[model samples]
Target: MNTTMNEVYVILSTYNGERFLSEQLESILAQQSVSIRLYIRDDGSSDGTRAILASFAQSHAHIDVEYGDNIGVINSFFALLRKVPPDAEFVAFADQDDIWLPDKLIRAVDRLKDASKPVMYCSCYKAVDENGDFLWQSLPPEKEISFKNAIVQNITTGCTVVMNGSLLTALKIHQVNTKNLIMHDWWVYLVAVCFGQVIYDREPSMLYRQHGGNVVGAKNGFALWLGRIKRFFLYRKKNSRIAQAREFLERYKSDLSTEDSYLISAFLAYRQAGLLKRIRYAIEMPLYMQKKSDNLILKLQLILNSVH
Candidate 1:
């Protein structure tokens, strides 16, 4: 463990993650990149999570663990960010249940060597059970990562990210709205996209595990199949969820930029709005101005044809 190369801190926030905490910790600790540090914050886990962490920290000199009240996940993460040592050159977020590939940090550091960017993320591949194996791969792929697609897809997986310390220094975590914003990753990505560069390695670097305890995961294949049997109902239901997300973004419009504002506006107005709303806004917003050109054309055609 040479202290010479730029140090990377792995920030992990745990809350009742006892079932998989050890595996996640080991996966990071086993990285070939020795210029690394592990920082774990226990969010008042009632489970044996804290005890397990204490046991592991005793042997792993580079691993540091802290305890705090049962604050929400976002707060726990921001609190971890606040504690990052000033000398740590890189910071990565870790989920308590995922397994990082041995070369993840090594490759990430290697990629960032000549990069002018402040943050980098890798593509994610799913590791799911038979119940929901096919959901993620079924979604359409963006040709590349950019501010435009990022607004919709948010391709950067929280656990796959590594942020440069320069970016962290510029971050004001406490000022962010912890209530409406779902997770720390979303805010981190938003900031990176807003003020710095975000690069990605188009490869999956971690086994993004799915279980009942996960906040979000793939839908059962059986359910997807059953939905196809009732296509109309399924379509409406999916549309409703997209509608809800857009509504949330709209309510937070004042918090975002015009460029970002329009992206979500089009995501709702052109790409996702109810037929009538789509038609009305399409005629109102300029064709070239909307980022999703294909969707815009479709909506404009619908507007001309008087489709409601």
Candidate 2:
């Protein structure tokens, strides 16, 4: 059991985030329990973001900042992950705009303090407007979180994630094409659920600030259902989410249980399956989304060859 609470290194990937970088940093600086260190990687921001990071790093011994070319968010996050110190006990992801609660680290650590296996804790977050006014609490549905669910969907939000050393070690020693990843957070969630443990917190640990510039935000009921269905068909072939699953399998196929390997391989090759095989995969595979409606949609995608 992990009896000791260890140092938490917060990894923040910043692009053109001059608008809310300081506030995010300040909120991180206020974390409780474990000692905190801030690691910022700038992805070629052509704005005042670098200057702000430099100024903050100058006065804060705990903050370390580095600048690199624009490699997109997924690669940028992996690049930041590579720079983490080998001895770091825990790792958390930070967005450029989210404001974390003061007890975020402590709350996550409390749940993970006794884990012996690779574990990650992710929490719900509050959705706020651009100016930080509260909009609504973004809670996850009380769905079964498992490798099957993770195979087709991501329930973990990166901004609220905290991973133990074992998971980070597994990621560090792995070789996978980060370019094929749909999102770094989703990939990590899949990995954790597949090979380790995942603790989902129902409470908000951070404020997810949505604005005109963000690509994803909180939606409810029918709108959220429709969006999920739309995305199911939106991505296809090798550029699909299932394609990312194929990548995940190739990277760690040797480590996967035989059943898991079979499951993922069927998902990878489902595009090539005949009508009979497609029906078999649709019925046999345990892949699912959090909501029953979305899970039904996933089954339809499998049967209709829409999950390519």
Candidate 3:
């Protein structure tokens, strides 16, 4: 079989997103990659989200909509994952409120095709308001990201990733059976870094929307930015978020023997609460460490690297 020209599946999950649904769909359907199929799973939205989906499905033969049992967003996406065709060469995730670039699929697929990597992800242009105003950006280099590193810092933007069939294989093998694994992107990234190759394009391809109703609104203004900086150093000092991430990493690390140890080391460092352990771990990887790295050498190196 000629797998090179196989179909691409954009598995999109939606809820009550009537306001931005059409725009998102338009952006996706307008992509230059025309051999794409939409596998949409709507989570029993009471708003006009279903209507918008119906309209798009009626007008586009490539679009197929599936009704989910109101099982919330994560489950709705998982439902689409289960229903994805066996012949899908590539799979990309889509949110209900983002505007994709015209060449999003083309660029991602081309990168994945040309490189030795099996997965491709890009950065996002965080659009906050009607003017497409700038919010912050997430353009962390892909080389610095991995399954272990993800536990310390989430560099993989969910909506900007394009993965291959290997992700589906990992999901089936890992059999992730968590009731609270609410973040699908993190899980998928984990699978990619663990069992497959992931290539990240530094270019931004999606217009990430931020609004009042979002689960976690984009941090805006100086005060919020400063607050985020403050919390970056202080949050793990007392909160359980770090512990939770570490636990997830530990649960899945056994599956990544083929990958490098960079991610695992980072995760272990974050899990350790002792200053001595953290310091020792930080010294070994002076150029890169997790949020909790507080060693003097690491700190000095970071300053020197940025002093120019």
Candidate closest to the true structure, highest TM-score: 2
* Candidates 2 and 3 compared by lDDT, better number: 2
Best by lDDT: 2
- 51: Cα error in model 1, Å: 0.8
| Candidate 2 structure quality by residue, lDDT tens digits, 188-252 | 88888888999988899999998866634666668677776567756453456777888898888
Model 2 steric clash pairs: 237-308
The lDDT, on a scale of 0 to 1, for candidate 1 is 0.65
Model 1, span 5-115: residue lDDT tens: 657889988989888878888888888854778888998899999999999999889889999888877788888888897656788889888778898887777766665
TM-score, per-candidate, Cα-based: 0.71, 0.93, 0.75
Minimum summed lDDT over a 10-residue window in model 3 is located at 299-308
lDDT of 3: 0.65
